[model samples]
Target chain A: MKLTILGCYAATPRSFTNPTSQVLEVKNHLFLIDCGEGTQMQLRRNKIKFSKIRHIFISHLHGDHFYGLVGLISTFRLLNREKELHVYGPKGIKEIITLQLKLANSWTNFPLLFHELNSKEPQLLFEDSAVMVKTIPLKHRIYTNGFLFQEKPGERKLLINEAVKYNIDVSLYNSLKKGKDVVSEDGELIENHLVTADPPPPKSYAFCSDTVFDPDIVPQIKHVNALYHESTFLESEMDLAFPTKHSTAKQAATIAKLASVKKLILGHYSTRYTDINLFRQEAETIFPNVDLADDGAEIIVE
Target chain B: MKLTILGCYAATPRSFTNPTSQVLEVKNHLFLIDCGEGTQMQLRRNKIKFSKIRHIFISHLHGDHFYGLVGLISTFRLLNREKELHVYGPKGIKEIITLQLKLANSWTNFPLLFHELNSKEPQLLFEDSAVMVKTIPLKHRIYTNGFLFQEKPGERKLLINEAVKYNIDVSLYNSLKKGKDVVSEDGELIENHLVTADPPPPKSYAFCSDTVFDPDIVPQIKHVNALYHESTFLESEMDLAFPTKHSTAKQAATIAKLASVKKLILGHYSTRYTDINLFRQEAETIFPNVDLADDGAEIIVE
Candidate 1:
């Protein structure tokens, strides 16, 4: 699993900093989260393949989160894309997009499916054999949601050298790799554990942004391989955190400490502060494994 | 008169090139036409005083034509702007924007007025003492209209040096500038032509884009100071122009020639071609005073 940060600034799009958006690659799927203005350009800058994006998850209806969505969709149609796109967002996205396409008289040749999310509780938005995505309820000024990407359990690996020395039949290798006991020709029961070794551990990532520090989300994102939380303000401006429903570096670190995540990545900074190292310093004071999320930064889960 | 091309590339937005958008400065008034994505950034790059922009005219509901409008409006509110913005666009723009704001529970502090154009026939949408913008009917996939921005006849100039040497009275100067003879305080009739000269001939700019080569609009934009028309295809690809409701470089020049326009500016080139000089050459074959539109390219009409 890997996460690529396309943009991380909060509020509005700027020349240097962008709004909220990212690409999360899990197993075989690429998920786009929270497309802001100039997001398509940012994606091109970061060398992201547009055709690989199959599923999109939006947090809320704020302009900073999803204003670039319509343009991206239109570009897809203009490129004569035939792949089907699945969109999951809050209510009103469907009407806003469909109405524009209808007014312009430019309908897509492909299929566009929208799943308007209006529920208040955590729910599963997408799931497949390799990965599953569940919504993590967040506290914001409006109806919002964060995504959790979890990888399914992988199959065990077989030790080829051990299997050859033990004279294991090639036809029974599949069953042996699945942790099954096989009966030999002499009616002797052979254990599969001796021939198979452990496979790599599956990793998961959680994305939480444009929200205040809510301790209740600890249980939902517990033990995630990586957690990306918004740090819109620094410790000096912590007073503005509660009123704006945003999180400061210290507050995000506190949540990271409470959740006990594997690693903490901070992003969605305010434009007032030019030096971003202050965020890492403030976060590292409480959470030692915290890192600042910069544009084009990639984090690998291993 | 000056024209600032913000984004003129056709189809979609890229990391460097942008989509269809421009700002025309005529008679000390800033009029924006067809705002696309990254337009606010383009305005910043061009050093345009965005606060002076009080009127925005959109040709159609295509995302590239008007996706940046909501972000621009939101930025105005953030800047604490007090000017009342008037937007003339196709129908459904108001509903799409207002509904998004409603869902986010954020409303603008300044006044935003909307003039939805759903009519098929040509009509006058806005007119002031210095400028008049009338819709020029065009053939397109959508209900698109071309905008003719003509500077109203300005006040006649007083030829300051000549008037001073002739000892013209201040009161008579004002009347002469209005093209009327007035009796001086010395009981002498001062002729308007003797004291004042005609003001620099009022100039005009006609913007027609996202449409095919429809001769019906030729008379509406005839003999303007300058014309910026869309050239989405090259002469070789004229076969594809009719199907897409777009025009080739030669076709656009044909209309410019028939209308007897002084200068023709070709833009909105298809993204398939990397070299844009061909478009200029193609149009110049028919119209000598032709130029290609590039990002941040300024055209001065004197």
Candidate 2:
């Protein structure tokens, strides 16, 4: 799994800093998360193909989180896109986009489907043969949700040399990979474990942002390969975090430690803080494996 | 009068090129004309004082013309603005903006007044003691209106040296500045023309964009100091201009020449053309005093 940070700042977008948005690539699917203003330009700046974005997920109704959505959709129509596009977001998202399209008299030629989300529980949002996505309900000033992307377990790896030693026919390799025993030509029974080794472990990534310090969500995102959490403030500004329903770097690190995530990626830094290294410093003090999220930064899940 | 081109390209915004937007500063009023997407950042990049912009004029409901408006308004609220903001646009603009604000539950703290226009004839949009704004009706794919900014004639020059030579009392100088004949202390009639020459001719700027080759607006913007007209295509693509309701560079020059504008500024170039100089070459063939509009290009009306 690979994730690209298109924008990581909070609130209004500035000349150098953008609001919240990112592109997550997992199992050959490119999912756009929280399209802030100027996201299309950011996508172009990063050289990400716009057609690769099939699904868009919005966390809330705030302007910083989803203001760029209508413009992007309009551009798709202008480009004469033919592929179907799916959007998942809060309940009012569909109305907001459709109204603007209606006003401009520029409806999309392609199938634009919207799945309005109002669930307060951890519900399965999307699933396919290779991957599954679930919503992690978050505590914020508004109705918000973070996403958890998990890759399904793969089939067992075939051991060709071991299969040859057992004199197993090539046609039976498929059954062996499925963890089934195959009879040999000399009337000897061969165990599947002797010919096939276990496949690599599955990996998952959890994205949490614009939320307060809520350990209750730790159970839902527990043991993920990587966790991206919002660090809008430093430890010194802890006093303002709860009032604004935002998380400090130390609070995000605490959640990562509790969930036992392999790595913690800190993002959504407040524009007030010029130096982002301060967030990593505060987060690392609580969780040793911490990385700062910057625009155009790509993190590969290991 | 000074005009700043925040964005000059047509249609969708790109990584390097922006859509249609400009700032016309007339008589101390910073009038924002057509706020396209990413305009707030453009304003910051141009070093414009956001607080000074009390009025915004949107040409049409097209996303490229007004998509950045809501975000800018929301940013004002975030900045805790206390001054009232006035927005003038097409009839449905108010509903489009109010709906989004309602959905987000983020009502502005400052008063936001909307002036919706659905007139086919030129109408007065705004006026003050020093300046007046009138709509320039244009033919397009949709209902659209360009703006005409006119500086009201100022008080006649005092001609202090001539006034003193005429033995005019210092207290009566105000009457002379107002072009009023003053009575000398010995009951002698002092001619107004002798003390003051005509105030500098009133300067006007007409902004016409996203319109077809319609000369009907020539009368409204006739003989203006500066005229900005959209030239979305070149003569080679003249066939596409009418169908798209846009003008060619040569067609825009024809309009400028017919209107007898002192200087013609061409903008809203199609993104397909990489070199903008071609537009100037094509326009200057018919109008010698033609200038090309670019992002951050400032043009002062003399």
List lDDT for all candidates, in order. 0.87, 0.92
Worst 10 residues of 2 chain B by lDDT: B178-187
What are the per-residue Cα lDDT tens digits for candidate 2 across A33-115?
99998888888898999887899999988899998899899988888899999999999899989988887877999999999
User: After aligning candidate 2 to the native by TM-score, how far in Å is the CA of A168 from where it should be?
Assistant: 3.3
Model 2, global lDDT: 0.92
Tens digits of lDDT, candidate 1, A251-278: 9989889998999999999988899999
lDDT tens digits, residues B203-292, model 1?
878899989998888888889888889999998998999999999999899999999999999999999999999998998889899988
Instruction: Give lDDT: candidate 1, residue A75.
Output: 85
Residue B246 shift from truth in candidate 1, angstroms: 0.5
List pairs with backbone clashes in candidate 1.
Answer: none
Which residue ranges in model 1 land beyond 4 Å of their true spot?
Answer: A184-188
Residue-level lDDT of model 2, residues B200-282, one tens digit each, is: 99999999988999989889889999999999999999999999999999999999999999999999999989999999999
What DockQ class does candidate 1 belong to?
medium
